[model samples]
Structures are given as structure tokens and as C-alpha cells.
Target: MDTMRERFVSTTSQLLDEDARLALVLAEISKDGFSAARRRHPDRVINVGIREQLLIGAGGGIALTGLRPIMHTFASFLVERPFEQVKLDFGHQGTGGVLVSAGASYDWPAGGFTHMAPGDVALLDTLDGWSVQVPGHPDEAEALLRQSAARDDRVYIRLSLQTNARAHASDGKPGFRTLREGRGGVVIAVGPMLDHVLAATEGLDVTVLYATTVRPFDSAALRAAAGVQNAADVVIVEPYLAGTSTAAASEALTDVPHRVLGLGVSRRELRRYGRMDEHLTAHGLDPRGLRARMARFLPGTPR
Candidate 1:
């Protein structure tokens, strides 16, 4: 019986470039679906055997060898445990490797504190030249992963364990699309939260920046969008803490008024949730909350 993971592997194999070697590096640790995914991408996947430091370190080596390494690890292990390795081996050297970190927040209840990663954004934000891509769904995830693999910069791809809540329109727009084009406020979103931003556009005249490449953002597009917003109306949203987009936006648009709507466990409480969807909705990070917040800046739009 074929499964989603199987289909994902099948699709990936077809989409990958013939000469490109894409390796999936599992965390020093593993997840529920890790083994199955490895089995699917057998020849192309590399399991690092629970070594976070080695997981990233080896990626650097693979990059030097011209193979595209997608380091598949838990957010906690990748961002917290071997952060130094990531900075030294990947970030500083600017190796063209993709960090595929799953369970980026408090998604897995069984993983416990040691496995939950809530500080990755903060850690990466302090560094420069690192491109971050937070995809909203399987399609976006696949697209961004391929793009990152093709690039020669240090790329980080954050993944969520649960299915995404939104699907891109079939309107021929790339997986990453710009929703609203108003010059009022720029609402940059990643992950499933994009549904909220689009819904919130019911009556506002804000410009929505949908990113397929979280890092190496389109400077021309971002600048064009920022050129029209009010000084304080530009906002960014992510399923993790605001650190990722906030820092990126500040650097990208130094003269704009910027705010970030960070998701995941609050800085104060990390142990409170039954499911990923439930936790997101309870904290006003879901569609309703996004719509409400966006409404403030784009009052001219319809209800």
C-alpha cells in the first residue's frame, strides 16, 4: 500500500535534477516518519546516526563535494545541540546545504523538552548570510527544498509534523504567491498561517509577500512592497517565534516600520497543548487572529 511519504518520495525523485545528489540527513535523533522516508529515498538519503554535530558537519563536506545535502533533523537537536557546528560548518562557510528541521516547535508531545526546539529562529537570526525558508504545505515544502538544493548559499528549511491547512491557488502563481498588492502594509507570512493572511485580506489594501525562499528573499520585490507601506504597518508571521522574519525584515527594510507575529510556544509557557492546530488557534495565531490584526492596518477593505 502506497502512502503520503511514498508519494512524496516518488514525486521528489521525478522532480530532482538528474545530476544532483540530494541527501536527507536524519538528526542524531529521529521522528515517527524518519525511517519510512529513508526507506523511500534509500539511495539518495543519508542517515547520520543521531549526531547533530556530524549531521551538519557532514553536510558541509557533501556541499564541498557538490552534492546537495538536506540535513533532516529535529529542530531541537539541529538548532540547540549543534548550533555551533551549524554556524561554523554551514553558516560561516556558506555551504550550499539545506537544513531540513522538523517539529520546529512544540508539535510533538512525546519528544519532550529536550526535543522541542523553540530557539532556532533566535539563534539563526543573530547570524548573517543564512537564507531561511518556512514552507506552508507539502507542495511548498517540496518546491522550496528543490530550490534550496539548487542554490549555492546556506539554506535552512523548517518543516512541521502536521499537515498544512492551506493550499495554493491553481492560478499558475508559483507555490509562493503575492496575495494583495496594496501599498499600505506588507504582510509577509510563512507556514500554514498564510491562510489567515489571505482571509484577512477581505477588506484591506495590504500587500502580501508569500515567500518560497525564506532566505535570499527577492530584494527587488521586498523593496517594491516596502516602498508603499506606512512606516509601522509592515508585519511578518511565522509558526515559530518572530525572531526569523523580524530580523530578516529589519535588515531588508531598515527604514520601514516593522512588527512580527511569532507563533509556537510562548516565551513563558511551552508545556500547554493537545494538538498543533489547537495550540495555534488558542493563541490567536490562526486565521481569525491574522485577519483581525491585518484589519487594523487595512480598514478600507470589505468585511
Candidate 2:
């Protein structure tokens, strides 16, 4: 894990250009282990110290000058604080830059209620010309950053503070490929818990959509994956309270059998954890826990 962190950090530390800039952002942050990234890349990483609104304004300025800026802060502050600036800067001008948001839900239990922000995705999704991607793993994170940086305009990338199980990507699998093949049902899992979907369908005929970009979705690929031939059953999973990613996919491709498996901190369990790692484990988001959830979907299988 230390070596992996170093590799990611080295990759991101070298991102002076647009393409490398985005990948480096995700890799460097992951390697930084939360606070370390801010220290490592303070120039690129403008920490407004919980001021999302000011951060957005600064981000706009950086983007306006043709310098790419990747802003990091808590999800709640990001959504509640600087929406207007985001609209005026990135949204109105269709400016090109990247925004990396952390603390995506019950990730900051120590910070109390003000820090828990589950509605961040829902709010960001409504913005136009913005690409929203909730990556499920490190590899996907790398790929999303690379892709987003290559494109122009506002790109919003979300990360859960928790570490996700590595998918088969390390074995030379393309980050955006269809991970699983199911003839009867197609289950798409986005965000950080895609490893769960891959583990859950050990034997079942399920096609897994490992999408990094949540908004400006790959509708053509999604429709192809959930073709009319296999419309009887399809399941979509996300780490948010409401299955917005899955619901959005279903709405995009109607007449497909789609079920959303939303996993997040319920109000009843808000105070049960502190770090994102603990919250992920408690919410059954860990690899082992995800295997168990898959068993419920595919009974009689060894989880």
C-alpha cells in the first residue's frame, strides 16, 4: 500500500500539463492520505479551510487564467457554501477545470452533523456542462482524472474518504471496460463500491457497468449493456442515500429492469462511527462486507 501510494503520488506530483494534471490530482490525494495532499501540493491544492464558496471563486480565477485548479474540501461545505460561485464561474463560462471533493457523507464523523453531506451528488448532477464521476477504485480514479483533464469545461470528481477494494484493473484490464458479463441480468455499480458488484456476481449472469463519470453518462454503452434482450432484471448500486446514479441510468434507458442498491449512513447510524474507514465498514461497504451483500442477491453462494 505504501508503494502504491508512492507511485500514485509520484504520478500526480508530475502533472504540470492538463492530461497529467487530473490523474495526478486523484493519485496524489490518495497517496497523501487525506491531509498530506494539501501539504504536498499546496499551490495546486488551495485549501480554503472549509470555505467551499471561496474555494469555488478561487477555482474560477485559476481556470480563467488557463491554469487548471483542483479544489479539495468537505462535501457539505462544497455544496452548501459555494454553489453560486460555481454557477457563475464554471457553469456560466463553461470554463475548463477540475474540482475534487472529499468527505462525501458520514466520512467525517468527528466533525459532527455539519460535515455529513450525502446530497452532494444530487446537487452537482443538475449542473450543465459539468462531468460528475464517482470513481469506485484507485485505477478508476486515475482514469477518470486523465479523461476529465483531457476534456474542457467543468469536471467534478467525487471520492469517498474510504478505501475501496481493488478491482481486476491491476491485472491490465482497462479502467472503463464492462467488468462482468451477465446474460440474464445486468447490474451496474458506480462510485467506490464497484468491487462489491464484481464479488457479488461470482456465478450469476450479471453485467457490471464500472462507470467513473456519473453525469454526461455513457448512455449508449449503458443501453447496450442493459439491452432489451435482458430487461427482466438489472441492479444499480451507489454509495449515496438515494440511488441517484442508478435511477438516472434507468431513466436514461427506460424499459429496463433496474434496481438501485443504495448504501450510505442512515440517520439512525450517524453517530456510530468516526473515520470514513469505520463508516464504510459499518455500512457493509468493505470488500468482505460487499461479498456478504452479494450473497443476499445471489443466495446459496459462498461470500
Candidate 3:
């Protein structure tokens, strides 16, 4: 099974072949993967060197010319580094393009904290009219990428090194998919956190909701799930910053009494450069850590 980034290169390359209106902009992040793509469509496949801002600027420029541009880069460089350009280039300009990001949170721990972007989604939340998709599997990533390419919308497809054991199919719509039903509260797992979440909540009577499309957050599904549960106690397990979607959850269940526990990467950075699994355990995202936390939050959960 190839990683999401590898699948992205192959899928986007095929997309370039299929769609004349589609263009890709990069900042030397995944240039090697797109070597053949560049050769095939030199005019469309752009590499703007190390300038992150220019990468977005170039994509936005292409969008103005009625071309659907897909900008690729590390999450930190793509969203955090060139945030101002992202805000102005795509949002302010009122143009549509796809921003595909890799190096999610701490995928490459050896690359140091500069490469991590746990707060990328939170930062984008401040902006308006951006559709965010966090695919847990390569197949989902390819599906979402192709879906985004077909439309001229301001879409952000977050690709991560972490993924679930299997892929969950979608109906080409944005919403959460309920994986398990229970009378106890609800657990919403986003992107790569599904498998861990499943393991953590095993034997616990709680509804498990899988979310790949976060923005335009499927409030209806959340409300519906909470409506039947014994308690509206919701826990959101994201692959990015903890509490990134807590506020959104609260808003979704504004009228109903509820409590939300957001879990993911901590704001307190781990000083030591360790393996990705080490980081997951440190952040309380592993199955053991998650079970402990979930047991405490949702009553009647077995310890």
C-alpha cells in the first residue's frame, strides 16, 4: 500500500493527463514524484523552488486564468509559512483552487518541529469558504483529490503519512460516516485517527463517526447521532491540533446540552526528536492512551 503522498503524485499526474484545465504548483517538496508529470505537461506542472509564498501566488494566478490549480507542499510550508498569501491569493481574490498538503502534524519527526503543522487546520478555520478534507487512506485521498479537481472550489485536501487499515467509501458528498452504533455518547474520529479510535472505544457503548470531510462540518450527522445517544458527550479525535474541532462541535450541538473532548497533537511541543509512534504515544493518541482518556470522559466505559 503506497502512502498518501505517493498516491497523490500518481493521481495528480493522471489528472493532468485527463484534464487540460487542471494545473499543479509545487515548491520542490514532491518534485521528484512528479518528474514524469513535468515532462508530460511542462507548461502546467510548475515548480516554484523554495518560495512558499510564490507557490501559492502562482497557483492563485493560474486560477485567475480559469485554470484549476493544485498547490502541493509540506503542511508547515504550505499553510503556516505562506498563510498571508493563502489568505490573499485565494480567499481575498475570490478564486477557486485546490491546496494539497503533506507532512501532517509530525509525520517526519526527524525533520524537526519546523516541518510539523498540528495547527494548520485551526489556522484555516479562521478563514471563510474553505472546504477541508482529511482522508484517512490513500484511496480516499485519491477520490477526494479527483473530486476537488473536477470542481473550481477553494478546497484543501490534507494528506498524511498515517492512515487506517482500510478505506471507507464515500458518495461523492461531504459528511461523516457512522461506523458503529451505541447508546453511550459519540466519538468522532478524523482522518488517520480512526483505527486508534476504534481500538480505544472497543466494548464501549458509544457511536463512532468517521470524518474525512471536516469543513462544512456535517452538523446534521453530529446532531442526529447525539439525538439518540444516552448523553451528548462527544469526543473528537483529530490527527492535527487537539481541540481544533471542539468549538465546531459545540456550535453544531448548540441547542442540545453536550460536552466535547478534543484529542490530538498537543500545543506543548516534544523537544526530543523521536519516531512518529513515540510522538503519538506522547500526545495520548495511541490506543492505550486514548482508551484511558475515553474511559474517563464517557461514563460506563470499561477501564
Candidate 4:
């Protein structure tokens, strides 16, 4: 399967070729992947090397100069490391760009803590007007990136190593997509967490909601998916930090009381180096772990 990172570079190159207003900025990480794009549009695709702050600053400068810039790099280095640049250069300065990040959460577990950034979205929540889309598959990633590149919004596209067996359209918009129907409650699956969510929720009496765009979170769609004003036992399974969307979910279900359980990379650091499965087990975010947690949270399920 083509990974999201590969598709991103490809689509970006294609977009840069087709659109004159598009520019791509990289920070040495994915520079090799974009060799062809850089060659085709040498001046547009700029790689500042290892300096994420300058990468974002150049993006902002390009945006200020009348071109939309798409910034790329690993998640931690892209968001957490040069966050001030993101804040001042992009946010405060009002320079808009499409920020695409790969290595979702702990996709690089062997790379250790410095490589992981589960709090990227949570930190993004502190800012305003940024669209966050987490695509579960490469096709979705391409589509989202394509769509965002066309517009001039402060957008963040998050790509990951994990993916589903198949790609889904789910309205082709940023909102709650109901894949399965039930009455127990709703399980909102974000980004690449869909596969695990599907496996875990099997045979359970609950509605499963899939979302590619979590920030600017579709509250109305979420409310509608629950089919009730007060959605009880609505679990949000994100690939990043746990409880990342609790506040948005709460505000969405404000009309009535609801119970929300946020599941994802836990706040606690394991302090041990391991693979993805090991991290999932530690965080209780794998299929088996999620199933056990759901059995307890979903009102009355057989133990």
C-alpha cells in the first residue's frame, strides 16, 4: 500500500505543477522524497535543512508574498519543536499555510521520545482557525491534501504509518461519517484508529463515527450521529493524545448531559522503548485493549 507520506509528496508535486500559487517547504526530512517535485519547480519547493523554525518562517514569508505554502516534516519536529514559529510566524502573523505532518504519534517508536509527538493536536487546540485533518488511508490523505492546497486556510494534515485495509469516502467532507449503526452509543474514530475501532466494536450495540477532520470538529455531525441531544457513552478514539477532543465533544453535547471517554496515546510516558504494538498495549489503544475498555464503558455489555 502507498503510505500517506508518499502520496503527500506526490500530490504536492502534482499540485505545485498544476497551480502557480502553490509552494512547498520542507525541513530536510522528506526532501529526498520530493526530489522530482523540487526539480520540476525548483524555486517553489524549498528545503531549509534541519531548521523547522526557518521552514515555517519561509512558509509564512511565501504566504505573505501571495503563494500558499505547504510545510512538511516529522510530527514532533514539525509541530512541537518549532511551535513558536507556528505560533508567531503562522498564527500571530496571520500568514496561512498548509502544514502536513507525518509519523503520527509513535509511528517511529524506535526513534524514541524525541521522535514522538502525541500532544501536537492538543497544542494546536490552543490556537484558533487551523483545520486539522487526520486521514486513515493514503487515498484520503491525497484527497484532503488536494482539497486543502486549493484553499488558503491555516490547515494541518496529519499522516501516519498505520492505515486501514481499504479506503472510504464517508461523504468526502470533514465530519462524522457513520459506518455502522446501533443504539448503545457512539464510538468516534479519528485518523488511522479506524481499523482498531472496527475490530474492537464488532458485535457491540453502538454507532461508529469516522472522522478525517477532528479539529474544527464536526459537533453537529457528532450530535446527529448519536441521534440524541445528549450522547451517552460516546467514546473518542484518537491516534494521538487521549482526551484531546473531550472539550469539543462536551461543547457539542452541551444541550444534554453525556458521557465521553477519550482514548489514545496516554499522557504517561512509558520510559521504555518498544514497537507500535507494545505502545498500543501500554496505552490500552489496541483492538483487545479497546474492546475490554468498551465492554466496561458501554452501559451493559457482557463481561
Candidate 2 or 1, higher TM-score: 1
Highest lDDT, which number?
3
Candidate 4 wrongly placed segments (more than 4 Å):
228-231
lDDT to native, each model:
0.64, 0.61, 0.94, 0.88
Per-candidate TM equals 0.77, 0.74, 0.98, 0.97
C-alpha lDDT of candidate 4 relative to the true structure = 0.88
Model 2 agreement with the true structure over 62-171: per-residue lDDT tens digits:
77777666665556766556778877888887677777666677766888877777777777767777777776666656666556555676777676654456644433
Name the 10 consecutive residues with the lowest summed lDDT in model 2: 20-29
Which of the numbered candidates is closest to the native, going by highest TM-score? 3
RMSD to true structure for each model, in Å: 4.3, 5.1, 0.9, 1.4
What ordering of candidates by TM-score runs from best to worst? Answer: 3, 4, 1, 2
Clash-forming residue pairs, model 2: 12-24, 53-82, 96-153, 136-192, 182-205, 182-206
Stronger candidate by TM-score (1 vs 4): 4
Give the better candidate number (2 or 4) by TM-score: 4
Residue-wise C-alpha lDDT for candidate 3, range 35-122, written one tens digit per residue: 9999999999999999999999999999999999999999999999999999999999999999999999999999999999999999
lDDT of 2 at 77: 66
lDDT of 3: 0.94
- Candidate 1 Cα errors over 4 Å, as ranges: 1-17, 28-44, 92-94, 162-176, 229-232, 255-265, 292-303
